[model samples]
Target: MVFRRKRKYREKIIKRSIWQQLPEESQNFFIETANILRFAGQFFVELVTPPYEHKEMIRQTYEIGYRTLALVSITGFILGLVLTLQSRPIMIAFGAESMLPSMVSISVIREVGPVITALICAGKIGSSIGAELGSMRVTEQIDAMDVSGTRPINYVVATRVIATTLMVPILVFYADALALLGSYVALNLNSEMTISLFLNKVLGSLGFMDVIPATIKTVFFGFAIGLIGTYKGYYSGRGTQGVGKAANTAVVTSSLIIFIIDLLAVQVSNLLMY
Candidate 1:
């Protein structure tokens, strides 16, 4: 009995040591996720307070939203074309090529379009925000704002977060439209479906549930991107290298969180639909 108890204690100690020695990669991930959550909370607090920066937010919105139009549009068009082309052979094999328009559009609007747009934003806007803020932190500009009795979070974080939240949905809307157009072009490559009938079929397959949930998830994606970027940049260390690291981590983490949240959203959407 004593030997068995000793063996159990040894196992416990080994387990504790293993836990303590978690890989550096895992530790960094946890720290980054925690920081994102903390920053998001602070962002919310600032969002509700007075002294709203309407002008700055508008400037940020244009910077983020309008500037990103080209990227999103191009990506949307490619996505739709590729998706349709790839799925066509498989659809034809089943003798169901006629279902292409509705299937392609539904897939795009419901999942691919928004997620792809968000990922594009994650790589572009997310990195820019992180690098910008990280540079500011290194230069002590944020500290200067603090010293001058201005709330840096209220000004910087609030504006970017709100800007992303407002803009991503609009981007998604445009992306959905562009993607559908591309898919329609692809469909015309082999078949002769009329534009009106194709649209009717696509819209018939999609209800408010598909559009609303997908759009809602984009907001969270925006939030995650904003929070991760700001957190990494705000707490950046070292010098130029630190800013690069902050931007790198912001894009990587935000992209990962977007996918994870997307999985959860799909599961929840399935439940709701049933």
Candidate 2:
């Protein structure tokens, strides 16, 4: 009995040490990620069912899209202009200013435009979704919906997710166009690259691989932002403080996940191509 007790105590010590060695932040991040995925899965299941809320979905789309155009357009233009100007000096040193249009176009289309647009959308939409749902949860509005026989998850999360998935791609398309125009303006600020010449160079370098992968990535970005926001807000429990915390965590976690997803997408794409 004494030997058995000693062995049991030793095993408990090893188990406790092993648990302590696990990074708390990493564990929390995975837990949060799994929760978001579960939310997204539930959303999709509800989304395909009937009693489709067309009007609500339309309203949500308008709210996400039209309201967000100005912010995305301005940021995209500035990103392109600044990226071009910054890259020009290095290209000039190499006597390769003629390569400016191609370089800027590829960079914008492949990564900059999509990633920046998503990050901006994450700040705008992610926090809003989190706060809205968090407020509902805190105020017992979701419970009220349940009492009223409304499926709150379907009514709320499904609309937001579908709206975001549809709207982000449109925003990305507009952003890419504006960014290219800004790049042209920046190029003319130094050298006289004609509009036709600038466009030709840009279009020549952009292939199906560049465009398709980048566009596909935006859908995942939208999904991540919507799901994370909804999950954080849906589970919030601490009143107004919970609302604030949900909003902050939604933005931070969604932003980090966006980058991670992008990295994984790149690796997967590389493997498929090679």
**Residue-level lDDT tens digits of model 1 in 113-227:** 9899999999998899999999999999999999998999999989998888888888988999999989988888877878998899898888898888998898888887877
Q: How close is candidate 1 to the true structure, as a TM-score?
A: 0.90
> What number of clashing residue pairs does each candidate have, in the order they appear?
0, 0
Following a full C-alpha superposition, what root-mean-square deviation does model 2 have from the true structure?
3.5
All-Cα superposition RMSD per candidate: 4.0, 3.5
Report lDDT (CA) for all predictions: 0.89, 0.89
Candidate 2 steric clashes: 0
TM-score of each: 0.90, 0.90
* lDDT (C-alpha) at residue 224 in model 2: 85
* Candidate 2 structure, TM-score to reference: 0.90
lDDT of 1: 0.89
* Candidate 1: segments with Cα more than 4 A from true spot: 1-25
